[model samples]
Target: MKLYHHPLSGHSHRVHLFLSLVGVQHELVEVDLVNGSHKKPEFLALNRFGQVPVLADGGTIISDSNAILVYVAKKLKLTDWLPESPAGAAEVQKWLSVAAGQIAYGPAAARLNTVFNASFRADEVIARAHDILAVIEGVLAERTFITGSTPTIADVALYSYVARAPEGNVDLQGYTKVRAWLKRIEALSGFVEFRKTPVGIAD
Candidate 1:
């Protein structure tokens, strides 16, 4: 398997982290986002969206980070990573939606502003980050993982951006439960961390 990714991208990091956790032997092909490599014709063939983190598993090509996570988990029969029951699947999907929506516009977007100099309202995005973190802190106070005791794709989905929220100037100082939850995920075997950038709060 080959993973086309950019180091600073949380979306790419989540998939890379999952692949490592599952012991999937794969090669990393770094996309030169700094030089418009992702927008070029060759890379566009893999993903019309011209995004990093496209997975090529022999003849099968998968785009989108969450979609890649689902495909790999299903193909590897990782029942714990992704439950099959209706209730469990629904719970996981709920968090995945949050990751794509609130998390994306919040912490992830904020990070993009600082790390890549993308245009985004830091005040608004940081506010959204705190709002979602408050909800997650409350949810995690009652359980070990986002959905339940065991970590799920939901956890993987939320991990990267939240872990690096500080880089977005979205402080993790107040949410004790959320901080602990991040540590728990880090303690997992074969865990790979998102590359830290000295920006935002660090600046």
Candidate 2:
């Protein structure tokens, strides 16, 4: 398998982290987002959306961070990371939705503004980050992982951006449970660190 990605992208990191956590050996093909490599014709052929983190497994092409997660988990039969039952799948999908929705526009957007200078209102996005963080903190207070005791793709989906929310000036300090959750994820075997950048600056 080969993962085409930009190091600074949380979306890319999502797939990268998962592969590492699962002990899957793969090549890393860095896409130069700064030079608009992802939008070029060759890259577009891999993913019409021109997004980083396109995964190529033999003849198969997988796009979208969460979709790649599901594909890899299912392909490898890593049912522990992604359960097979309907109720279990629904529970994991619920947080994946949050990862794509609230987490995307909230903490992710806020960090995009700071790290990449993407044009999003700082105050609005930061507030949105805290709002979701509050909810996550509350949910985490009731259990070990997002769905239950075992870590799932739902936890992976929510990990990268939320762990780095501080870069967006969305403080994680107040959310003790959330902070503890981050520590738990970090402590997992084969866990990989999401590359960090100073707030309001590129590295």
Candidate 3:
């Protein structure tokens, strides 16, 4: 498996972390995101969206971070990371949706604004980050991990951006439970660290 990713991209880190957690032997293909490598025709062939974190497994090409997580979990038959039951699957999907939606527009967007100089209203995105973090804090207060006691693809989906939320000026200090939840995920075997960007609150 070859993972084409950029170090500063949270979306890429999400997939990288999951691959490590699952103890997969893979090659890391660091895409030259800063030099427009991802935008080149050759790269666009892998993903028309021209995004980092594309997984190339044999002849199969998987794009999108969440989709990659699903593919890896299913391919590995890691039912513990991705439940088989309908309810369990639905529960995991719900948080994956949040990772794609809220987590994207909130913490990830804000981090992009700071680290990559992407144009985004800092105040707006930071506030959005807090709103979602509060909800997560509440959810985590009642349980050990998202969706239930055991960690799932849902947790992997949410981990990178949330753990690095401070780089977006989205303070984690107020969300005690969320902070603890991040620590719990960190302690998991085969865990890999997301490369930090020294910006905003993280500075």
The prediction achieving the highest lDDT against the true structure is 1
Error of 2 at 166 (Å): 0.7
- Candidate 3 or 1, higher lDDT: 1
**Candidate 1 TM-score to native:** 0.98
Q: Candidates' lDDT values, in order?
A: 0.95, 0.93, 0.94
Q: Which tens-of-lDDT digit does each residue in 1-203 have in candidate 1?
A: 99999999999999999999989999999999999999999999999999988999999999999999999999999989999999998999999999999999999999999999989998999999999999999999999999999999999999999999999999998999999999999999999989998887842
TM for every model, in the order presented, reads 0.98, 0.97, 0.98
Worst 10 residues of 1 by lDDT: 194-203
Candidate structures ordered by lDDT, highest first: 1, 3, 2
Clash counts for all predictions: 0, 0, 0
Clashing pairs in 3: none
Q: For every candidate structure, what is the RMSD over all alpha carbons to the true structure, in angstroms?
A: 1.1, 1.9, 0.9
TM-score result, candidate 2 = 0.97
Question: Number of clashes in model 1?
Answer: 0
If candidate 1 were superposed on the true structure by all CA atoms, what would the RMSD be?
1.1
